[model samples]
Target: MITRLGLIKTSLIDYPGKVAAVLFTAGCNFYCPYCHNPELVSGPVPEDFLSMEDILRFLEKRRPVLGGVVITGGEPLLHPDIGVLTGAIRDLGLEIKIDTNGSFPAKLEQLRPDFVAMDIKTSFSNYSRVLPSGTAAEQIVRKIRESLKILIGNGIPHQLRTTIVPGIVAEEDFDMIIPEVRGADSYLLSGYRNQRTLDSSWAEVDPYPAEVLEGIAEKLRLAGVPAQIRTN
Candidate 1:
């Protein structure tokens, strides 16, 4: 029984060019400030988890109209049963896209989602403070990097993304992340929204403009990293 906080029936935005339903799972491994799903991040999972029957009912009803399902989360990898959920969805003959922080490569290997979108936190990502002290942070990143290699080398239909938190990252952060994923299929430079954040300091900081994001994306593209600039 996975804890679910929200569900969007159709999202052109989340999955990008696909007509898909987005299911927002509760709980996250990291507390990123710019995270918008505070209803999920700021609280405990409800005792009444969303039943598979309900999800299946809805999926069956919309099976003709919708293309697929996109399972996103604070961190879907935290759930041991994600593979079960996505496998069930695949049984309905629909494509699946998973959005993750890339923390659990082993679990992800089991899930085998049709497409995946991974968030690559910038160097400014407060590894020490936001993440649970010491052990958890390092291990999560190691798995993320390893899975990133697997996804790229095996030609998974995936995209890598990094949210631009203004004033947090400069030119140098790319130096750290780009080398790891230099020739990725697609890299999305998303502009952070100035709203609810886990940390109060984040609300005060402004987000970078679209042009600045484009400049950064262009630089990455020039460095042999294929990416696109997407601002909302």
Candidate 2:
């Protein structure tokens, strides 16, 4: 079983249109400086972890009121037992939604989640900035592209997300991103929050104004991409 890092018993917005339970898994491959959940990203401390059996019992009790389960993480696909986890949740008759960084296309295809939200940090060419050094940027970008194609080709209900970080993501980056997410169900531009970020220096950086994100969304919509701005 994957380590249960944290859980929110009830969330209205985590899984669109449903009252859901949010389960956070630990560890991530990407080192995005602006990541808010630094603890989860680096892997949870042993004492802070929750047992999977305990979480399942809570979910089983709340199954009557809960509509779905959202399996999110530093990167949930990194867990080898994620399929077993999701399968258990499905057996409870609740829908499943997953949030991923798009690094594991093969695993993503196998999950076949009811809904997916893949983070497109920036253009394919700029992934090196967030990924660890010595990482094969080209191969990972190819995997991300493959993941995007899977979501689109399989007709899966998914959304592509990008956190509008001042230095990492600029307006021009979307020009490159737009084409990749053209067929996605929607493109969501989320504003960056400078609290508990992975990199301490990033905590001092100011996020783009809401109007700026609105303008970017407008441009994407005009370009035939279903775009929306989500305030953090």
Candidate 3:
């Protein structure tokens, strides 16, 4: 149903123990400034972006070379046909991993990916910015919470992540996030990198100090989350 977008042939971090092809679906529901894939975010994707057919064909060719496919976004769940895409990938007998904002519980169930990466936005990331003040914020947060619960209760292979933006995300923020995602297998503290981002402000803003990040990771560890820090 949703066929338009770009694809990355490989990613080492997206899928463990496997060479993976990463699909970047167009569009998103949130406006996190540190979003690395700006082109896929609010910006228009290339007119020459590969079709879903082409992607599947490419995956078929890369089968022996790649272990699986990582279905990522601009909030992949925002695409209405995500389940169709994942179902096709699953039919290939290659594993499917989905990277989402955790904003679509029903879709997550429909896809039933082998792995899921859920972004836990900070409380400081209030609704007025990334989310619309109208129905968007409450609707999106409700879905995100439901998705988290489904992932946790169903025993899915998943990790909860928070991108640590220096001024935006504070150390105490984890106090709220960790408890909600306590049983997650992995809790990732991804340091915001400014090499590229949707907004120019991100490139200008200094990242959180490693010490601060490490301190948050320490807090996460104390919170009983098996946390790992990644600085880029």
Candidate 4:
């Protein structure tokens, strides 16, 4: 089962240059303290989740108006029926973007989404700090690195997103990431907003200043990576 947990009927901003509907899948492998969707990640699945039939019917009705669909998660690739879900959405004549944590490069290559928005969370050195306790740090990092290679090597339209969390990511961390995504086309530095975080302590933490984010973006630009700071 795909186990869809939530759906946003319409969004002007989730998918770049397209009016899209966002579908949130339940469950994730990572246990990021800064995650905003804790409910979808570790909490109980809501009983009111829109069934695949319901989602498809709605998409059919909004076909003329919606330009695309964004399947985000708790890590969308974690679900076994992801390819099946995407196939149905693709049949609707709308582009699909899957938001993921870069855990499943093979699945992504197989699905061949129109666009992929993958989170870089933190520098590879800090993976153990961000991932769930007891996770194989080396293996996961290797997988993430492989995912990046798969996207860039295949020329898949993708964006590498990094959330500018206060304590989790510092100014120097970008230095470590610069070489990793040197040839990337798009890099988004998302401003962290502390709201209902997975770790309650993080809710009291503040985000980096706008200038701090700009500085990080500048570093990426200087390293030959096209970067943008997204406040929203």
TM-score of each prediction: 0.90, 0.96, 0.92, 0.97
Residue pairs clashing, model 1: none
Q: TM-score ranking from best to worst?
A: 4, 2, 3, 1
lDDT rank, highest first?
4, 2, 3, 1
The TM-score of predicted model 2 comes to 0.96
Enumerate clash totals for all models, in the order shown: 0, 0, 0, 0
Candidates 2 and 3: which is better by lDDT?
A: 2
Segments in model 4 whose C-alpha atoms lie over 4 Å from true places: none
lDDT of 2 by residue, 32-133 (tens): 988888888774444666788888889999999999999998899999999989998999899999999999999999999999999999888999988987
- Could you tell me the TM-score of candidate 1? 0.90
Which sections of candidate 2 miss by over 4 Å? none
Model 3 CA deviation exceeding 4 Å by range? 124-129, 132-135
User: How do the residues 33-108 of candidate 1 rate in per-residue lDDT, one tens digit apiece?
Assistant: 6676665664777555466668877888887887889988778778877777888788889899998888788777
Off by over 4 Å in 1: 46-50, 124-126
How far residue 134's Cα lies from its native spot in candidate 2, in Å, is 1.4
lDDT of each: 0.77, 0.89, 0.80, 0.89
